[model samples]
Target: MSANAQMVAKYKNNFLKEVQEQVEMGEWVKMCMQCGVCSGSCPTNFHPGWEHPPQEIFMMIRAGKREEVLTSPSMWMCTSCYNCIVRCPRKLPITHIMHGLANYAHRLGMAPKMQPTRHFAKLFWNNCVKTGRVNELKLSMGLYFKDGFGQGIKNGMAMKDVALGLLKAKRLNPFEMLGGHKCKDQNGIHAMLKKARELEEKRKAIKAAA
Candidate 1:
């Protein structure tokens, strides 16, 4: 094969197998006519220092520019408000493509370097898949100490009313917060979480290199 042909083959997007199999909302990518409705409907213009809108990311994916698509800043900024889905001429859920790209970036260890954002996402994902639900108190307290006691105190105060209400409604138990074996399989949960953290660390190292 010619060098150009070989390079093109190497960088081509494998969106077909991915879009067909896992993603439930990606059917419209093929039907996209390059009308800029999605770009116009984006609630806030996050584009800066870029020549094109998010449609370019979709274009790159369609064209098989794997490296460029994965590394683009536009892939990570999706707020998922679904404005583009509502406004799309082809009725494509453009937001889903953004999310699909984000998930792909996360799996590839190439997600953007918003530390707090990344940290919260890691913690949330770990909690959900491992525990089936998030213990927000645990997350908040964890963040508080990581940030500072002042933030903790401020957080506690900000949540004072909510805490009181929860207590009133019997929605929470302080004893549980203090020390409770809420999960029937706490050991299993811990083991799974440990494995998840190790994988996350490995992915971060890989992303650093990528």
Candidate 2:
């Protein structure tokens, strides 16, 4: 058998199972026609570092390359320009699928080690969820210090000029970092986020029980 056929046969159960899971995760990916339009429209596909564009990612998903797909850097490269979606003959939500796959990978604890974007995204989300606003200084500190204090200092030094510029422009506050800034309706923000999380958990439970 050909290599493609061999892989499918070797992991037939996983292939079928993950295909069904992904179809349920992002329904539109199930309709991918392998037309390659999505990857062709994707500017990142030309970048040497980008290994799996939308079409290739879907194919990998179908082929049961679960670990590779989850660890792929390409998922984080989507620019959300919607070029693929606009051009897709199948009308697939290609951009959404990319984001979905990234989230799915992170949720499964399969994201590649030292994925800076993933770390940054989690830090950003946590800050936003806590205050209903992104405290730039806190977010930056969190991201930089995530690896450790030493790395944080190094990162801060690297961005010294940009940080100074922001400070000069009054875009960031040192005092807020210490005193902590918060939304006026902190209670309302907490309530809304709690409700959203509860709903998300409910959805996950339903999916798990299915």
Candidate 3:
């Protein structure tokens, strides 16, 4: 069975339990009282807007709408502004929960494939983790070309002035595309990241066994 399928069977399809055991800070999901303050406090809710706000997501988790909750783009909309956390009467770590849900959904391959936030996050993470330093030029290029080659050219044209300004200011380096400067101890950086992943997996396994 696929990893996701095995997880589903292991959890007996109890999504809330799965989240509690799997996601970071997910054990606090039950503290939500269905108050709409979190939704109201969200700036994205007024502008770009999400399908289901924090409270609604919690409700869905309780109701066991695993697929809907996991596949929705709502969690990816979180900007980590912490407005929800600041305003929540329960003092719940709402921001952490939202990010945790997004991370969990991503791990399960259930997040929206084309979600811009998710795409950008992946690009940024890969760009930084590889060398222990962000290649800003490559990161920008990746984002510009995320749509397509034609769109990428258009995007570049639109930002030509800004690019010129950055180049003149010496803040943006064209040669970094060849190979950016990385941490001195590249091997050590990779080892640390690998160890972190191993520790995380061990922690998750322990949680699951509990």
Error of 3 at 100 (Å): 1.4
- Stretches off by above 4 angstroms in model 3 are 1-13, 47-49, 176-179
Top candidate when judged by TM-score against the true structure? 3
- Using TM-score, rank the candidates from best to worst: 3, 2, 1
lDDT of 1 by residue, 1-210 (tens): 999988876585675444433333454577788888888878654556233455766676677776666655565556677888898877877887777666666777766655454566667666555555567667767766666888889878888898899889998776765564256786787888789879756755554454
After superposition, candidate 1 runs with Cα above 4 Å error = 1-24, 47-53, 113-116, 142-210
In candidate 2, what are the lDDT values of residues 1-210, reduced to their tens digit? 899986665444465355345433465666788999988898767875577888888887777676677778888777789898999999988887788788877777777657666677788789888877788888888988887899989999999999899989998788986676777898899998889879867776665467
- Which scores better on TM-score, 2 or 3? 3
Count of backbone clashes, every candidate in sequence: 1, 0, 0
What is the number of residue pairs that collide in model 3? 0
Task: Kindly provide the TM-score of model 1 when superposed on the true structure, using C-alpha atoms.
Answer: 0.58
Q: Using alpha carbons, what is the TM-score of model 3?
A: 0.86
Clashing pairs in 3: none
User: Could you tell me every candidate's TM-score relative to the true structure?
Assistant: 0.58, 0.77, 0.86
Q: C-alpha displacement of 65 in model 2, angstroms?
A: 2.6
Better candidate number, 1 or 2, judged by TM-score: 2
Ranking by lDDT: 3, 2, 1
lDDT of 3 by residue, 112-209 (tens): 99899899999989998898888888898899998899999999999999999999999888787567568788789899999999997998899899
